[model samples]
Target: MDMRAPEQKYDPYRNYTRQQWSKLRDDMPMALNADEIAALRSMHDRLDLREVEEIYLPLSRLLSMYVGAHQRLYIAQRKFLHIEDRKMPYIIGVAGSVAVGKSTTARVLQALLARWSPKPKVDLVTTDGFLFPNAVLERNGIMQKKGFPESYDLPLLLQFLSDIKAGRTNVRAPVYSHLTYDIVPDRFVEIDQPDILIVEGVNVLQAGRLPRDGKAVPVVSDFFDFSVYIDADEPVLREWYVKRFLALRDTAFHDPRSYFNRYALLSDEEATATALAIWERTNLANLEDNILPTRPRATLILKKGADHVIENVALRRL
Candidate 1:
């Protein structure tokens, strides 16, 4: 006697398949070439013009629309309040698991957005720089938890984001070196009010526990005007990570200054095992506990197929 249909769950996003999403490109120019894309891609990532045309062009076009709208709203607010303030850079946060090609996506967007008709100044920043220095991690006895939220200087990062959002000029962020696998001492990169800033990292979208006292503690995503989360299956992520680790043995690991120089001595079998162990211990744990949980918080989700091509896009409903 019950004729009611099953209860439907609410979904916040408007999902689009590959063909559907690509149609959103809507004549966005091909601003990057094959050679340019190659240079933009990370060593272990695959990104070609087709991917840019099919996936990234649509994304860049969508962001352009959002940027234009925000600019107009800023002007309208100033007029109504009868006060003048310098425009702040639109901050975009890109988050994903390691080896899922988040860097390539960020870089590609930077390239395309810079080519906007007026050529807005765009800067790319990675949260890797805000990670705790190795010595501090060692002192804190959390070296093994290096990529976890606890391993970051959350207060320092928040301060930096605050300055950027307040239209502060010449904001300094610490420099991190992959070769040394640590934060570079006394070195910093100054961000000078770019028209837009792209902050990319594995943990940019992380949200820590809230206070019960009703005090506000802003997380990293608070600074973002729009955010993206890159996603792939867990097994695929592990496979890509292992492959990249194996490939690095012939590359970065061969450098005497490389922190992973010792890995060059590992045979294929040994390196694979080592990569698997690291994935199980650090990266996988961080992804599951911290990163993946924040996926729903993104403005858009770029889901990838096993071959690393973006197969679907989910844009949050307004």
Candidate 2:
């Protein structure tokens, strides 16, 4: 088989094996230590110093270059217009399946980007915050579809993005609690202007609905200067989801306030069975019907193996 992740005559991506992609790091030094990388990783995800140097280091360098270019463009635009307009944040969208470690990737990137020269302030935001409250979902009869695109408030999300791109300050977004598994009422996070903003979630790359009249309707990805998608086979993702769920039963689910606290009382076998049922009924359906379809929209793809390590990368041809 070819070393490429996928083979297609008309493919828009240039694929690279792990070894091949690691070479792209060139002489760049590692920016993170083992402890920092550990803290940045998701609860059930695997990330170490070597993973950072081999995978994320090169990625961070490439993103810094992109950010620098965007900065330069702003200066040129100012010169051309003979006016100093406010600098716009370079938004990056990170999208993938629920258990694919998009949160880990986002946090790691934010940390590394903030360390770049000129010292940019990077803000990391997840679309989980845009998810409708449980009350709203239940009222709308779509509570089971929580991670589906419909469970999100697209207008509010889009408006928040619009405000950030327009250099607005103190722009507030809703807050979500994974433990409670719902949106927190009257809670919000203010996003001031930042050099780069990473928007990560399972649905960030999804497009908004279009009207038949052909009027301009801005989708979530329309605001992204760059986008990344984490990819893995369905079996791998299912296994990861099940593993994470079982681990959570021993950890997060033990919290009395956790929405999944009931799972903590189940036997290991029972927990596993309950997890598989949820995966099949909710997560799997969302992945197939919503998330996976947006994969091609990403600017870069990180393809992971069964071990949760990035096996290869596919950079969309510019």
Candidate 3:
């Protein structure tokens, strides 16, 4: 008998494919019943039951397990330290391209997670809340780079998450205004101790690589209990961005209070062209340079098909 070395199999961080995902659906929890499904149905007109069942069902199930495990670990650590009763929020980071529907996913997860027995109240906070105000972006000459990591107040964001994860009470985050395209003055959202906090944004998983005299700063994913990256082909994302821009231009941009009021009058073709230009200049650039590279860092990866439905899910196995 010939003796040979055992071959090392590839260990992909994204471990699940479409077929394996179907198999996992049998064991995942069902948090949303018919009526709740009906409500979310109308809200997310783009998705249907099958997509939710196969994709989000498994994803939420994974998150629930993560939440439970984190709680157990917290308790165990505290007990070992001889501390009294305590709790910490399990932080989830959701990252994706601008119009890839990560915000909708975060909202849906928040609603579903809150319905769990003993109902752990889930708080959804977008990194948009940490975006520098328009005046500051303008001063820094980065108004066009709004979704880039540099556009946000990184220290403030890190401190806010540090507070939440450290179990701080009455922690408040600045509110952002889509209509005005800036951080609202004085307005804020106070997040008390919660079972889970989902933070969604474009560059949440991006590592800060600024040459700090000579070393790299800590990456954002360092704090995430679980992270998800929403993904789709570049062309599909471009089409969605253009479509969303046209829809928003026809609806929201026409309002007198709208910061994009000037774009309201663009003809369909012109609007599409402008949207493509913006994508080419800003969003696509950010996706290529910052967002896409961080995909491997996520614990879960939701891969959307050309039709904009989640066709596959990839889980990073333990």
The best candidate by TM-score is 1
Q: How well does model 1 score by local distance difference test?
A: 0.93
Ranking of all candidate structures by their TM-score, best first: 1, 2, 3
lDDT of 1 by residue, 153-228 (tens): 9999999999998999999999999898999999999999899999998889887788999899899999999999
RMSD of each: 1.9, 3.0, 3.6
| Residue 3 accuracy (lDDT) in model 3 | 61
Lowest lDDT 10-mer window, candidate 3? 39-48
Q: After superposition, how far is residue 312 of candidate 2 from its true place, in Å?
A: 0.8
Model 2 spans > 4 angstroms off = 1-8
Q: Could you say which candidate leads in lDDT? A: 1
Superposed Cα deviation of residue 281, candidate 1 (Å): 0.6
Residue-level lDDT of model 3, residues 95-166, one tens digit each, is 999888888788778877887778888998988989999999999999999899889899898889888878
Question: Over the stretch 164-241, how does candidate 2's per-residue lDDT look in tens digits?
Answer: 999999999899999999888899999999989999999888886779999998889999999999999999999999
TM-score computed on alpha carbons, candidate 2 = 0.96
Candidate 3 error regions (>4 Å): 1-9, 27-29, 33-45, 210-216
Residue 161 miss distance in model 1 (angstroms): 0.9
Q: Give the higher-lDDT candidate: 2 or 3.
A: 2
Q: Which residue runs of candidate 1 sit more than 4 Å off their true CA positions?
A: 1-7
Clashes by residue pair, model 1: none
Of 1 and 2, the candidate ranking higher by TM-score: 1
